[model samples]
Target chain A: MTAFLIENKYTVGIMLGVIFGLASRILMLRTDYRQYPTYPHGRIIHISLGVIAAALGAVAVPALFNKDYTAITFLTLAAQQFRDVRKMERDTLTKIDELELVQRGTTYIEGIAMVFEGRNYLVIMTAFFSSLFAISFTWYYGLAAGIVSMIIVLALRSGKSISHIASAESVPVKQDGPDLLVGDIYIMNVGLKVNQELIAERGLGVIIKPYNPNGKATLSNLGQRQAILYDLSTILGVYRDDGEPALIPMAKLDMRDGRLAIFLLPQEKNASKAREIVLRVPILESAVRMPTEAKVNQQEGS
Target chain B: MGEIKAVVTMHKQQVGGGAPIFVADNVKQMEETAFLLEKLLDAAVHDLKNGTFILVKHK
Candidate 1:
């Protein structure tokens, strides 16, 4: 039993480091420090320092048996790795947020994108864990595990992040001009769930019917009225006389799946004309006769 | 995964005009690295504003 423990000390230590690394990442992410510098930075620094502690733990666990300078060397390397991870996480978030904010306001989607950032931490985590593995155990095993974990985490986080962002329901701008550009912004809440393929594949289409008192402004009337839809690409067509406007804004067209619906609206103030539609109430068909109020009242009485 | 070494935004030109870029790397650098990064990013942003940058990424 004692022998088994001795042999497995390094393995145990590496596992512990993995667990510690995961926890630290989560904590650092949760405690965003840039805004509340004192409080956030304190928490982040603690975690950053904790990473070194974790590396020491890895080295010490094996050192109990090996009792060599090798463990000491690894401890040094791991400490550096930990420091790198901490700095990366902090710097990336800070720089990205600064640039994004300069480009767009907090209310814009750019703020959310800039703020809810990741990727750097993920890469560092993979490297740190793998290094721990290689130093503690076989290099190949460590590399394999580290690579696998990194890929999995990246995939998972991407989906998760994307969905989270999407739920926020706004386009994050990294560059600025206007918030309401004449383009369809693909929304993904977390990294996992994305509407890119769906939006691109299906395209926008009329779903909600526009209101018209005489019922003359249905999508079919596009032949009679003028309408246009533009984007990175262009789609232009005239209304076919069915009450649908002649030009449907590409943004208004959406994939037919139950997931999304598309429709047109009048150009909102400040929005680009090429991208935005100016919704207009349709004039009543000249041929349609209106019933007299007296007749309607009589029908209601009966 | 190690922490991100650096997160740099780049710019890439598309058919229509151009767009700002995002480039992330995991390599460590010396003190001058930060200054170099700033220069690169600033240049990219300039291109984005001017509609000239075609593509930018971590080499």
Candidate 2:
């Protein structure tokens, strides 16, 4: 039994590598509160792709040992395929965003699509390294390498959230006649008496105060503000039904101080939960603006 | 559908070429014009600060 194990070491290595690679992909693929990569169909699609990626990674080392140079071409093909996957995700999310009360802007959608594409590449790298270690040394070595790679993957699982860049505070929702204000920042005008009454009764307000110039600039972006609104509405569940645009969640910028005021009539009506959601909202990569790093700003500072 | 009781007017001060739309003299007139537009053309009102409100058709 020991002799047989030693004889087919490469085969054992390949199998272990493939298993590790698949495990890493599975660990990373998650459909959280957002319900993205939707249920059975979405999970199946990603799993299938992960299998292909794992297979490619596991097979590459053996193919190289056999001197089959053509195997390298498959990696290139896989790269192209993953790029297409990113595009598919972007298109689907964009279409879905249109139907949303507070749309996830193009920037946020693109960031999410990019994340999906990048994750596949990470899977490929993990599998490739695990297989390489196994083929060069032993199956045990490959397992160790796989574990280390998985840790790295886990470490980089997600990006920074809004709380990292700004502080969110629960603010007073005031109705001055027909105008709605979130901590002195004008949100909207409720021309209808009924709408005014509804807002006065149920509306909750939050003010996001940016930590620095960069944070301030990011909050100023319409897309970033919309992303905040979309996330808040998605988690808390919007108060209004379809066609009731009057009760839609809104995030408005305070032009004078760069603070963002968000107003929403949530079904949950939990102020602490809403504030937590805003704080934990992932900062969209595309919406991040660095005014402090700009050349003009540097020159002015000098 | 509800009665158009209040209105908000928007003034576009930019480089453009189009027929002059209704211009309101005061807040009351603006509210009346906005209400009329809301009823005549089924649109949702969005406030874009500085006394401007955009009336867009809801999808």
Error of 2 at A281 (Å): 0.4
lDDT of 2 at A274: 88
Query: Which portions of model 2 miss their true places by more than 4 Å?
Result: A294-302, B1-42, B45-59
| Residue-wise C-alpha lDDT for candidate 1, range B1-59, written one tens digit per residue | 21222332322223232333334232222213333543444311112222222222311
The clash number for model 1 is 64
Writing each residue's lDDT as its tens digit, candidate 1 over A38-116 gives 3667456645555545455544544645667566576556546655654555564456545431111222222223323
Question: On residues A83-193, what C-alpha lDDT tens digit does candidate 2 reach at each position?
Answer: 999999999999998787767889888988998888888888788888888878877788889999899999988888999999999887999876789998998776645
Q: What local lDDT score does residue A122 receive in model 2, on the 0 to 100 scale?
A: 83
State residue B39's C-alpha deviation in candidate 2, in Å. 8.2
- Candidate 2 local lDDT, B1-59, one digit each (tens): 33332335445452123323455666667666666665566665544445544455644
* Cα TM-score per model: 0.24, 0.84
Q: Please list all clashing residue pairs in model 2, or write none if there are none.
A: none
The TM-scores that each candidate's chain B achieves against the reference are: 0.22, 0.58
